[model samples]
Target chain A: MNRTTTEKVVKSLKQRHRKEKLFKAAGFASVCFGFLLVLTLISDIVIKATPAFHQHWLKLEIDYQQEWLGVDSLDYEKLESADYRKVLRRSILAMMPEVSGRQDKRSLYKLVSNNAEFTVRDALLKSPEFIGKKKNVWVMLDDDVDSYLKENTEFSQTGIRISEKQAGWIEQWYNNGLIDKQWNTEFLTSGDSREPELAGVRGALTGTMWTMLVTLILSFPLGVAAALYLEEFAPSNRFTDFIEVNINNLAAVPSIVFGLLGLAVIINLFGMPRSTPLVGGVVLTLMTLPTIIIASRASIKAVPPSIREAALGLGASKMQVAFGHVLPLAMPGIITGTIIGMAQALGETAPLLMIGMVAFIVDVPMGVTDASTVMPVQIYLWADSPERAFLAKTSAAILVLLTFLMMMNTLAATLRRKFEKRF
Target chain B: MKKLPIILSLIATSSNLMAAGRDTISVVGSSTVYPFSTVVAERFGKTTDFKTPKIESTGTGGGMKLFCAGAGIDTPDMSNASRRIKKSELEMCEKNGVKEVTEVLVGYDGIVIANSKATKQMEITRKEIFLALAKQVPATDGSEKLVDNPYKTWNEINPDLPKTKIEVLGPPPTSGTRDAFAELVLEGGCEQFAWIKAIKKQDKNKYKAICHSVREDHVYIEAGENDNLIVQKLTTNPKALGVFGFSFLDQNSDTLQGSIVDGEKPTFEGIADGSYPVSRPLYFYVKNAHVGKVPGIKEFLEEFTSEASMGEEGYLTDKGLIPLGEAKLKKIRDQVLSFTPLKL
Candidate 1:
């Protein structure tokens, strides 16, 4: 009301503005720093995981001598039974002339897998004609050899660890060009195994894909239909409200509980096969259903009431009004939510762990009931494996799962962008 | 933040305790060894006025990782393993500045294939067991092939065995039981099959190709880590067999009979006498560095592996194990008590 008071207020306002400006600048710097920290973390993850993707190769060109196979005699049993590995080892030694004179043949066998002889035996069995004939071959030593070469499994630790002799042999082999660890893309292409040496991600990736596919297939239609009924078709009453509350509660329920429910309802009562991806998918569906329904209903509610009124005014049937108009309009949100829900299901290890989806998945699954492992389960199993080197494989799997999420998010964004133009 | 004053007092007390040449010793390792060690620690602690040793159930690998995690001040004082600490893992321990680790082979783990005692015919064979559990069998080309339903529909891989649906409840990979099972049963036998080794080489896939390609109708169920769940499921389902450790079976054998593997029925007499074949050794690895730092550890370890810990009627056997016989027990006790360092 007075000039002096007005002057004081203006001065105070200016001071407040300067303080706010300082705080805002600090806030921006803090946010940027936080993002940088995340970037560093992500970079570390990428760097750590990249090594797992590119395996070291011990490519050896073994002479598959023809005469050793006894192919000329036409004796399949005799040819298969003969020790083809001796010729192959001789051939590998022949190829690498520098590594000779250091060790006996028996000692060389221990340098690689105890089963390397078996590998050679298998190759001979597959194509016995190659025996006694010179042919180039590439073989991977077990993961331990890889780790030993890569320096992940250090030899210098004083304890009952890797033998001094084994470590020395690995070094000698590397120096003499007898073994070279190379990036094996086959690791990614193959499936998980009990042997750490032969393990891959194929079983897990496909399991996640099939599980998510089944989840999407079952959850999307049923969820959207339920959402439509609840939001538009159902009578507004206490029962509906109760049902809605329960659905929300179901959404909040721990996923493991759903696994138990699936065990009782789907596996026990309905006779669905246990440990099947179908059962896993069904369990995930129950875990994800409420999420999809809630999102679909929200999207439906978001649509302007005028569109429905206009459709009715044009003599559209109730079904047409709901499905032909409202449903189409709510499609984007439904897709996004459904995908997000599926992604949520994708990362879930606990429910599947309970549902028996974490079984040792050897080959890729071909059907719904096929016993298979998902990516997270694969990561868990690999992490828990006795070999210390699978620690890298675990991170690599996390990278793949994160990539899946990124892909789903990209799809959601593209759909959202496409749908926004229509509205 | 809430315990500023309390923490200050605690720090002061710790400093005073440090001045007195004593500190709280943290011992974390195997759940299997936890029982034996905790009992020893409690008795030793009470007698000597030293603190009771701490233990954690983390499976063998996890316990080793924690024990060897070179966060020097935060490292565990000891590690326990149901199986031998793998060579690669021992390297990891050494790399992490855990210089001196004393590996003690405490006793044998007679891994019993447990089922509800109410069931009849509580014996299974190595051949039957192989047919029932092996991931691969003979397909074409004498190679290992996958059997999807190992015991789902029929009991007999051979005509001699009775036909019954095969359903097994077992521990997840997280448990020591699973480790022992994979090693003692799967590895020891699976590799023995001429057909299996071939397929394992050719396919190179883990268990998928091994698990799939079987009858859609045949039976196998993947039970998780909870031994209790398996026990419960076995009681309810007559077709089911539960695979668990010996301690659990010995504790609950009143209601469960040990399934004979390859006709060798699991029993105290059988195991101690080496007639039972499925049993494995139990082990504990103490951080040799912490011997003096931790009060009463050397004495406790000494007491743990004495004839008192694993005699014919030792403390461990009293709890729920079949104790080793005289000569074997003496050998094992000498090995553990002497603190002989392992070499690969």
Candidate 2:
């Protein structure tokens, strides 16, 4: 070969090497950018949610005088109907004797939770001997006070509702070591409340559970049956083809449209109750049915035709072969699809909004027919709240929801890994 | 999978229980009135034997649709509204079986134009605000003519105002707050011009079109119904203003301040009285047929109207509900106790 031809080949080889390096760097940079975005989002949510894990409690000396309660004896009826808030207010005023004006006293009383009286009453009811005694009790702090103590600093004091006097009192309590920062259990145990400090996600969690249970029970059987019939039984005709196309189309339809359909047909035409998990679950079934059916059909089709042919050669009936062999083999994929569908239903809020699930329900729903709100709707409501403490609560609720989704996906992965056969 | 039958039967039995009737009172209504109503419901639940009433913030129009559907267990027992029930709504209710409804005037709520505390508080008049935000403003020339809004900043509208761009964040047209603001602030300002005032009698629809249409320029941002987002945005952009309900101002008073309008600051007393020009009365209508059918409707009404809940110094005041005056409150209580059907 000539020298010029060899030189040209060498130069082109160098150029090709440079192009390969450039493409590799670009791909690595894109992956890094995606990771950085996700990391920033998760870290921000974790930081904002940290403050909600613990809450402040103020130690109070309550003198539950019988006179203040306006009850002669600690009878069950009298104790139940006693004026514990007056007693609670008296105890709070005892801490700040210098505050005499009506407004000052009212502001001072606001330092503790409005529900502290119930705490006091419950303590007394548990031990009736404390009715006439001065006992030291720890009461939950108000939401504003909790937020102030957590975020307040020498440089910036941005507590919107905390007044100067309230700040001073908080500082005094801090200096005197009367504030207890403890793990928050009420946030997990109670129901929704107008007060941010008292609100919890138990009501929403139970609602989600009930709604998902309904969705799973109704959608799985129906979805699997449709898929089995379509893949194993239905002849390849125009009708079946049209149905297959429509199922794929329905899978792409927006979720809110299903909500409107539920509102119009389920609630309006059929006379079903509103704001119940039953209606929410029914609406979500409509949404996830198409998805599950498509997934199940794909997995069912993956079963080898050779197995069916061999079973038929062995004199087995078609129904026996499909149910006993194909169905079992497709079970893993079917379960995976159903779990994914359930997870999607768990995070849905828009469709439920039309069925009247966007509500402020204070009770933990006991049954499918009870009025309830789910986790995403609860987060939306809390995020829209005027109270500043609800901001942290919203982030904390998001973390909880993310954890729930992660657990569900992990379960799906484990099930697939445990039962799936490569062949 | 074997337990599926049991679950299905359970759902069916529970729904049958629901058909027997709802024991707890159900309330649905305006998002503006939700804060006050929820607090009252909580108090009622805690202090009494009844279940806590479930509330849906379905807005005023949707609430009326559900409330007037029928006087039965399936429909809501009460509907709250930031405004009075319209005549058309009354006829619709009559068309259904909801023949009798008792209207209870709960309290008042003020709509405020607020800004971050970083900037000086603004004292804006209705005429200046109209000139600043209207889609069509009276021409600067002496002639009675309307043109696309030409003012770019507040100082251009009124020399006494600050020299800042006329950027305001507010709710969309779907929000009731936006409706009240159009009727109260925008229309109040439009009335200042003698020619426009004359046009109202001749062509009411034309006057509304002139007064109600806000500018489509980037100056007015439709920030959805989340009031907290608007508050956060105002803090970040100190020069911008926000329009929202007064409860938000009360909750975040330290970081935000309401702009004074027409010589009245949007205070509790100013709104409770007639001094605040942008305040509206909140009302809840109860279906009289469901009073006895529902277990705790009467008790819930008593708790809501008693001196402890809606009085001037009541608990609802802490949440930014402006209470009625003493005589008016007494008259309302009497009317509610009697379950008087609305005359309209």
Best by lDDT: 2
| Per-residue alpha-carbon lDDT of candidate 2 for residues A25-124, written as tens digits (9 for 90 to 100) | 9999999999999999999999998888898999999999999999997688889889999989999888777789988887888889878998898888
- Kindly report the docking quality category of candidate 2: high
lDDT for every model? 0.67, 0.90
Encode model 1's per-residue lDDT on B1-344: one tens digit a residue: 46546644653453344334324455555655554554455444433445545444456776787778773544567777878888888888778887667777777777777666566665566545655665555442444444343354333565554466676677665677766776667655555666655667677675334422222332445576545456557778866677876765654544567777777888777887777878877788877777776676777776676775567555466445566567876776676566666678
Give the clashing residue pairs of candidate 2, or none. none
Candidate number of the best DockQ:
2
In the order shown, the candidates' DockQ scores are 0.01, 0.82
lDDT, candidate 1, A21-111, per-residue tens? 9999999999999999989978877876765765555656666665654445646666655655566567666754555554444345434
Candidate 2: where are CA atoms >4 Å away?
Answer: A1-18, A154-159
- Taking chain A by itself, what TM-score does each prediction score? 0.86, 0.94
Over B203-254, each residue of candidate 2 has an lDDT whose tens digit, in order, gives 9999999999999998899999999999999999999999999999998898
